[model samples]
Target: MSGPGTAAGAAGRAGQSDALEHLARVGLIAYGMVHVLVAWLALQLAWGGGSSESADQSGALATLAESPVGKPLLWVLAVGLVALALWQAAEVVRWRSGWSASGDTRKKAVEKTVKAVAKAVVYAALAVLAFRAATGGGQSGSGQQQQTTAGVLGWPGGRWLVAAAGLVVIGVGAHHVLKGLKKGFLEEIDLASAPPTAERTVTRLGQVGYPAKGVAFAVVGALLVYAALTFDPARASGLDGAMRTILDAPFGRVLLTLVALGIAAFGAFCFVRARYPERT
Candidate 1:
């Protein structure tokens, strides 16, 4: 009879399947498309024109849903995202299984584990959202975020909890900014296979894209902190709210335009990543 070790070995092999890797790469394309749409929406908001679409991932997915082949595309995106999530899950398992044998320091192992876990959660959530959009049961992420904030605020010490959450988000944003500025993202890409021009293009896109995304997230975190302090959930709107807030500032148009372009660059970078991912 096959024992646990035999079953585990089989499972590990399955997780490393080439088919799954291909699907995950396709999922990266879907993710890039979402960012491109968000950039378009943000530009519209910056110009004081365009429909009432929210300038965030939900809005991007909604825009996709309204296209001629929206539902079909969403289904594909959903499947790809699921595959990506599973890939991350496999990475987490590998990290755990090889933690001691890998010869890496404890800190490095922990960091890799954390990053894999985070990616798994994010990809899984996006997959669910895509599936919901495909099924005509989609809801606004910003609205949901606000509602969750409101509910939390109603609990004892909820304000503190919200503030803590906001701080964590800010920290994440700062990390992204640092990663971009430091070219840390290149560590994950096998640029050795890319042509010189392609390498330059991808590097530039990541450098610009990371900071823009970081700025947006930082603004969102600030809004959450403001909402907690004021005891008002309306102030806790997500990316959409952040864009509007930027619009109200001096030289808002210029700033928003730059940020939108940066987001677009990031989206383009995703396409390159899909094609040139580092092999484990």
Candidate 2:
């Protein structure tokens, strides 16, 4: 009894619902791995910045660049970032492309112009960065290029921007996790479960658990920033000093453990998203 139009509509709806679920799950997986990598990088920076040893200029960038294995791993992060952007862009394009189909030609022209302009800006920036990196001009010429440390974060710099950036990423992750909680898991459940008291507790747990995890990432990122920036490199044992700083902090181990747990939870969410697919 189903007509062609009816069948087509049903197929379209199914496709859209599946796409959202896939994107959300893949996004969570990508987000988690990227943070773990970033955390490792922070440790390296802390060690290098706080060390009393001389900087390695010859293969500085090469040594730091992620390896073949690392590169593939990092592709996961790139996917999360770019896929999210493109997914959003596609939504905008879909709506606008048709709205002006029969409308004023000028409005359609403007829309096309804006999209092109935005793409150009992104391409231009990438081109510049590529040019610089290829030409060995990534670092500013500051007399011997004494190997850039976490300098901006320490002495005269205070590392405010670097630390803040990590914190901001944490905030972004929290936003996504909280959104998933509200939209993905909790919203689907029956709000009026029997045993009303248990329902409130369960609801609250779900609400706070993921968001709390995000806070953990932010906290660890902040700690790494503080250790690398504030730990003095004046002494030969300065690297040790930084490690000690972390150790000496109240409940530092506990905080690190919490960050690790957050990472694991993120991984779990990604897995669930991937395995379960999605339902409308």
Candidate 3:
């Protein structure tokens, strides 16, 4: 009787684990879809197409809203993204518990936890955005960013706070660039079963995509800094605003187009991630 109960408990736990993994997989695919849409919007702008929206996450959701059966898709995306956030949270907890083999270094565990936290925040935000879209309360991510900046700027010593935020964003951008250069993203992916050609393609895509995203983030940070210095919250734009700023610069079209292409490459890499996510 004791052995049967134990077996039943073990099977239940395994089923739960399987369910969570499936949810995470769907979440990853949804994440990839968002990136791909963002890349498409960026490309449209690069080619001189007119758009009233920013090339950010909100923009991507908005684009999806315009499609047939958009609402249902948004609901699905929201569910998946929320699951992904939970997955990241689980990773953080696991790292905190030192669940890995003794060979794993403390430094590596810390790094992984930090990365997971960041991803959790992002995935949660995306989930909220998707839910809003599904419910017909969709809002612009860029606009929301500006509002937040304005609120922050209204505080005492607001300028300093804004400046600090800008610096943090810049740091994040630099990290992205570094990760790309170092091919550190490969650490998460399990490519043992992949063919050499597929591996090479994913590698190339990541190399271009990460740095390209880094550049965009850097631009956004600069704009935030500019806003802080100028006492203008309007200048504190989001990803879409950053792309516009790039396009408005000298040879802006060419520069933006190049960046757009890089972002698109990153989006392609996201698809690969969806198919072959990193194993713990």
- The numbered model that scores best in lDDT is 1
**Candidate 3 per-residue C-alpha lDDT over 134-203 given as tens digits, one digit per residue, 9 for 90 to 100:** 8878568777888999999999999999999999899999988998999987765679866788789889
- Position 155, candidate 3: lDDT: 99
Candidate 1, superposed: residue stretches over 4 Å from native: 1-12, 98-104
Lowest summed-lDDT stretch of 10 residues in model 3? 7-16
Question: Which residue pairs clash within candidate 1?
Answer: none
Model 3 sits at a Cα RMSD from the real structure of 4.4
Winner by lDDT between candidate 3 and candidate 1: 1
Off by over 4 Å in 2: 1-27, 36-68, 90-209, 217-248, 276-280
TM-score of every model?
0.93, 0.38, 0.89
Model 1 TM-score on a 0 to 1 scale: 0.93
For model 1, residues 62-156, the per-residue Cα lDDT tens digits are: 88999999999999999999998888777766555545554456557567778888888988988998988888886787898899999999999
Give the whole-model CA lDDT for all candidates, comma-separated: 0.86, 0.41, 0.82
